[model samples]
Target: MAIEYLGLSQINGPLVVLEGVQNAAFDEIVEMTVNGNEHRLGRVIEIYNNKAIIQVYEGTEGMALRNTHTRLTGHPMEIGVSESMLGRTFNGIGIPIDGLGDIDADKMLDVNGKPLNPVTREYPRNYIRTGLSAIDGLTTLIRGQKLPIFSGNGLPHDQLAAQIVQQASLGDDTDEKFAIVFAAMGVKYDVADFFRRTFEESGVSDHVAMFINLANDPVVERLITPKVALTLAEYLAFERGMHILVILTDMTSFAEAMREVSSSKGEIPSRKGFPGYLYSELATIYERAGIVKGSKGSVTQIPILTMPNDDITHPIPDLTGYITEGQIVLDRLLQGQSVYPPINVLPSLSRLMKDGIGKGFTREDHQDVANQLFSCYAKVGDARALASVIGEDELSPIDKKYLEFGQAFEHQFVGQDLQENRTILETLNIGWKLLGMLPRKELDRIDTKILDQYYQPADRD
Candidate 1:
């Protein structure tokens, strides 16, 4: 016989305390009825001495302590899993919202997926081309790696994400391409609509799925959005052997939502009023990306988070940096100069790209070109600083060249048109062309043989 309890204990925001509950387990799904017939879903978060506190996913908007009836369902939260989920749009909690009927679920999967075995993971290799020079040439995104984009407020992080979705996958066939699983949490309604409109209008591959939780939706659903999205990615990648690319945007929203739930639980807050377990909670999501030792398919991740007040030391991006492989930072200065992606190449890098992009992968001189670009760009700042003290006309000939190279690097290399899709070879060629504007001796970063081959002096004299 199932146990049903009459609730009159307490209610706090999204949480409700039900007294005298027997045989209740943590994370056990609960069914709550309001005004006799209308039902809502909840799950037990904390259990103490037969008393359970449940988080209502639909929010406790209509229910009261006295009128609500609660029943504990034995199992934890689960979502139906199947390959049919592709090319569909879903609400935060795995329910289809694209007007496409119910999924033909092959099986049900627990939203909190199993922990990945460290020994089973394969170090990521091979590059995933984004068709953008700033990334494809400088901070190459390697397959099966977890690379994050650290953006600030008002930056085009959302537009950048859509561009990535339109270009991230490779190969022309269904089996050869990568499947995209995108999760948007605590985003504005217009932002969600922009994603949908872009994906459909761009004819983004049928191997794409999105889970969205809007600003007005219940905060509890924001927490569940990423978990359910990853559950589906894991199913497709590890089990069904399909290459998966997971994009999680505005992770700051997720962290904030956690703070709200934690505060409601009366838990002690850590740094910046976030829970102490924030790091562990974030790891559970990021570490889910990678390839197992024997699996042909890999799960690569690009998690985007906007820093509060553009502070890099903020707990959200700071903790994320410790867990992720590397980050792509968007610079406000570059944005002011009218760069589309606004990627500050000096600080942004991919840790595993060195192993992925050389010889057989991208090009023979890929590493050399990237190194020279970084070295020259770094010197541009020094030349500009000296110019500020003594006028630009007073600087040495070499310093003047540095200023010119910087201008070309930003306007020509980093910035590209929205419809422009440059191949790896094309990006490398542009790098060499920019390097040519400087004197041959200034190109000390490149090897003597490489300079002899690719460096052609311009009519700067």
Candidate 2:
């Protein structure tokens, strides 16, 4: 039997500290009762000597320090899982909120999942097409890779995330068994409603499992939302043999929750007053995505975070960039131009793009075309900056042409309908058309054979 500690020494924020604790384990679930029978759930976060600090999930608003009772459950927080989870809507802590009954659980799994063995982990390969040219043709998302989308305050990352959920796939029908675990933290009611409607209206709701933590909810719950979502995703992927894509939005909120908890616990602060262990703490979640050697399925993660003040150096985005595979950076300047899914291809990259493109994957010319397009777009930026200094009329003929190509690239490539779903072939062909605007002499990135095969000047095409 586990020990029960009565009369906590202190209640601070969402934390409750208990004294004279014996045999208490870290992360053990604790049941707290006050006023005779009022109950709440908490977990042991810190324990040393005879003192234990517990983080109450439901907050400690009205509980007095000397009246609360804590019972250690001798188990870490676990979420019940079953095949019926698909199409269901659950709150941050895995409780169904869609008026549906409890999941007919096949098993109960700990949210703190077991890490994949490094020796048995597989290198991420094969493409996961998001059907967006900016992503598919340039920064391709590979299965088992943890790529993130870095957006700003007003950018349309939510719309972009919704579009990806509706259109993402594992190429052809050979691996169509795909599922999505969409987790949102600290989102407004309207924003949450928008996602729900987008998924339902697109008819992909049945294939998506949603975990939402609203802004009004207790800040402590924000910390548990992503873990619950990833837990469900692991069950769907490794156990049920389905490809699972876990999308976590606004990780800034989750990080803020961590800071709050750390401050409440009187822990030492690091950069920007955030907890010093922020990097390792985030790794515990992001590193959970991958393919194990013997497993037939894979887990790909797309964690979205808004850069505070559009500053990439901010702790949230900076730490994320270090942990994830790559990032899709959304440009606020492009968003101002009324572009939907305004993905700035130059700054965005997918580190595992090489393994997922060429030959049997996307196309033989995908690599070259993407490289050439980047080169041309880079020149366009230079030309535009020069034009601003010395009038466009004074610019060289080639520079003028680059300006034209840049406009065309943004219009036809970077900007697309929210509902647009372009196959890799279509995306590659469109790239060829855009590349045709540039002179053949500048197409140095492409092989001579590829240039000879696909390069057509605007007049010739």
What TM-score goes with each of the models? Answer: 0.97, 0.97
Q: Give candidate 2's whole-model lDDT.
A: 0.91
**Stretches of candidate 1 above 4 Å error?**
171-175
How many backbone clashes can be found in candidate 2? 0
- What is candidate 1's lDDT per residue for 54-163, written digit by digit as tens? 99987889788778988887999999999989999999999999998999998999999987788888888888889899999999989899999999999999999999
RMSD of 2: 1.4
Look at candidate 2 and tell me the lDDT of residue 298. 92
- Tens-digit per-residue lDDT, 409-451, candidate 2: 9989888887899999999999999888888998889999999
